[model samples]
Target: MLLQGGAFSACNLAIIENRRLPGWICNAAPSGRLGRAHSSRVMSVATGEQMSKPHAPTHQPSLANRLRLGSLADDGLSYKEKFIVRCYEVGINKTATVETIANLLQEIGCNHAQSVGFSTDGFATTLSMRQLHLIWVTARMHIEIYKYPAWSDVIEIETWCQSEGRIGTRRDWILKNYANGEVIGRATSKWVMMNQDTRRLQKVTDDVRDEVLFYCPKELRLAFPEKNNASLKKIAKLDEAAAYSRAGLVPRRSDLDMNQHVNNVAYIGWVLESMPQEIIDSHELQTITLDYKRECQHDDIVDSLTSPESAMTESVSELQGSNGSPTSANSENDCLQFLHLLRLSSDGSEINRCRTEWRKKPAKR
Candidate 1:
């Protein structure tokens, strides 16, 4: 279902007509030929969604690393290190389509990483989808939910990078029909380059930049902006008080990633961890937007603040109005809040600044 908000109050969101999604393709056979017979429909990236797999994990979080020495199960494939990551199973949602995010990843040429975080917005407009589809995210692109008209629940996603870069790259995904040959969705992504040592943003070099030009389309390979600011920035201080109204600690070496900066998505872990499990279970987000002002480095102390102003209505429960305490204020009204996340380096340097907004809806139960 489309976002139910009415006109003027609604966000203008467009998705490919459902008929445009891919049908299905059989598994690759032992001979290594793709699609012994091509389907009647040729789904294009601009028109449809496609569909795959992730890594073996350790209890320890991972850091970014250079090409490794044949550690990936040496089954002897030509492109071991460059294998496409598939969506074995993703909780991808339809309210926010997966195709939109794939396109975002396609914009960044490879040798890049997912740099910023993204979520649905509070104030919707032409700029809403444009910012998400055309820009880098500050956090991990999550699969909220995915389903098509014909299927029960076999959503497949295939993710791959065209090439690697010092920090940026071209990436794309195919959302496919698991049992048949169909392209249900598609995604294009872009990445940001960074200083591996300082974890600061870095300009891509001519050699590395030129290499990405091959896989990137003309529009996808636009001139890189120093930052993703909608307007020129006014300097905000790195002070402790202005920092936030809560805090979290990062005491792990693995908290660092290949770029030497904390991986962009790691902060989400911090945010969710700070909130109660009941809050997550009760709320369905209307929209969430993230802006990454700086990077959190190794051993940095990440501070967080959940403002009473941005609090979600569902997060609070009140006594039945009749027996209310005399000093009690109305809890149901004005329960929304703004969350401030302040991450700092071990040396007390402000590393990342973020603001998260939430709206609360009552639990159906």
Candidate 2:
């Protein structure tokens, strides 16, 4: 039976269709895999519609029907999916949160890998990688949001991956307002392989390279082009002498992902834990760049440190110079920028370093 606003179990898989009434049709099959199951129910939480009759157990959705949920774009190199921003995914501002946006990016990236016949054992790993006990680890990520979608808003996300030299791969995404096709945000990330057992960085093997390259686009296309790529610059490392710090931050059991480590999105929340209340209240995150250093376990204690970019002039002057100085285009367009760091409390080893830029919220009319 359909349950309004109810969470799907891990064993159930839900495929969303954008129709007159957008809704999820969940199949209560084992491990969330699609199979010959007649116990499926339509979940239309947006309009509170009644459950539809169960499909015949012997019948299966056509490939075209399945692709409607999420499919490779016309380019054949990128994958696109639509998601309705659920109430739980929004914040007090009645808009989607940064964590929610990051989660959607991760979801689309995984779906793109799956669409191209990659091994499902882990995040975008190939069958050869699984045999070698290898996994992908994020190296860097940069995201910029022009606008945040509100609750119930349907947003379309497209993502594609390309080779980043012999040691890493790069993935880029474009997020759009599905109703009007307005670009809402764009993000790019870099990832490298690692040995699951030894935790050492691994080079991309010829087998693995050939497997993924076959699906990549022949010509290079980036979400953020390099000509006007201010966001592509390297993020400066925040020092230990940050003015604000919150220690003893622990990851909750729910914070871990399939890799049995703290999810990358969780680190964003932890980084914000030490942010000044004034900034959090008066401004909204506009751009953020994260450089992951090492993984954090569930038991590892973390410390979040933050400092205003103005305070780190000595260390970041070169970066600011390269990006060009901020100008007074509009007095109301002023922004607040900060450098952040998340480190283990045990030996003070770095976990991640970040830079965040925020814009003042428009005054309520």
Candidate 3:
């Protein structure tokens, strides 16, 4: 489904086509290939809200069309695919928030993996690797935004996976304006598989490695840093006078993903909630870096803490080894910056840390 831009007309086709999917294209949706046989049944959800409308028919595109839609750069070499999506009313910010973009990136990433037959269910069924109790988790995410699409804007996201390592897999994305083909932004994320039953980290097995490597082009020009050193080793320390804190924010069922853990995208909103209203009203997020240290479950009570750049006085060297450096220190910039922390309210266990930079709203054209 290719949605062009203007207004709701640009979104109509995309919405109609997406409704044909047997299940939601969200991280919380069931894994594996969705078939027409299951399209009519009501979805049984664990934590999130159910759709008010009926289930939509699923569309499985032909192989040729899939390649064309993704605008495959080189046949037989790249597995990059395109996902055409619409920005919905709920995802729109006063200026089409950065959190919304993060959500879209997450969706396309899952879809790309599913298209290549790398789903959680597939690991058990196709590969017969059920004994591992596998679940995929994002280790780190870094997004740089050049522009934020507003409600009704049609976006075409092209994504692909990089080769998998024994412990990590890399995925990259490019967001484009559907109407004129303008570049929107790009993001890259690192992921690792874990054992669901044992709650222990699992290495990428040989079978999994061989399958993902088949699609990964060793020479692909897209690049992400090897270590994420800056985003990972930076820590945010908040004092009473300089920080604003929101306590006892619990994760709802809706925040849980297919893995039954709080979705990483949900953290963006929780962290933003602690920022001063004035900054949210006057500025827009330009870039964000998040390092996931631990998972938050539905029963966990989370706390979000935020402090402006003015309040963050520590240097990067000071945070090298502290708390494993979940985040980075703030620096002066034309755009405003905020240091954020999301922790368990009970024992103050750090869930994840974030750093965000916001740009002033541009003057009306």
Q: Give the alpha carbon lDDT tens digit for every residue of 1-365 in model 1.
A: 01100111111122111222211211111221212221122233323533211111112211322232111111111111122223431223323222333322222212112111111231111132223322222321222112231213343444444333554443444444455534433333334543333445554465445423422334422111224321122223334443233455673676554335554445545644555444455443322223455666575676654333322333212222221211112244423344444455344554444333333533232
Worst 10 residues of 1 by lDDT: 1-10
TM-score of every model versus the real structure: 0.40, 0.76, 0.68
Question: Which tens-of-lDDT digit does each residue in 270-331 have in candidate 2?
Answer: 98999999888998887788888988888999999999886322211211222122221223
**Stretches > 4 Å off in candidate 2:** 1-68, 311-333, 363-365
Ranked candidates, highest lDDT first: 2, 3, 1
RMSD in Å for all candidates: 17.8, 11.7, 13.3
Which regions of candidate 3 fall more than 4 Å away from where they truly are? 1-87, 90-95, 120-129, 223-242, 310-333
- Which candidate, 2 or 3, has the higher lDDT? 2
Each prediction's Cα lDDT score? Answer: 0.32, 0.68, 0.56
Could you give the candidate ranking by TM-score, starting with the highest? 2, 3, 1
Clashes of each: 80, 0, 5
Which 10 consecutive positions of candidate 2 have the poorest summed lDDT? 1-10
Per-residue lDDT tens digits of candidate 3, residues 1-365? Answer: 00000111112224323322223221112322332212223233321445555434234443442344442233222234444444443332533567667776765554444433333342211132344566667777877666666656677776667755797577776666677776666676777777777657778888767645654666653533334423344656544453788888988888886667888888888888798888867776766878788888889998899887664322323213211221222345447877888888899888887887777765542
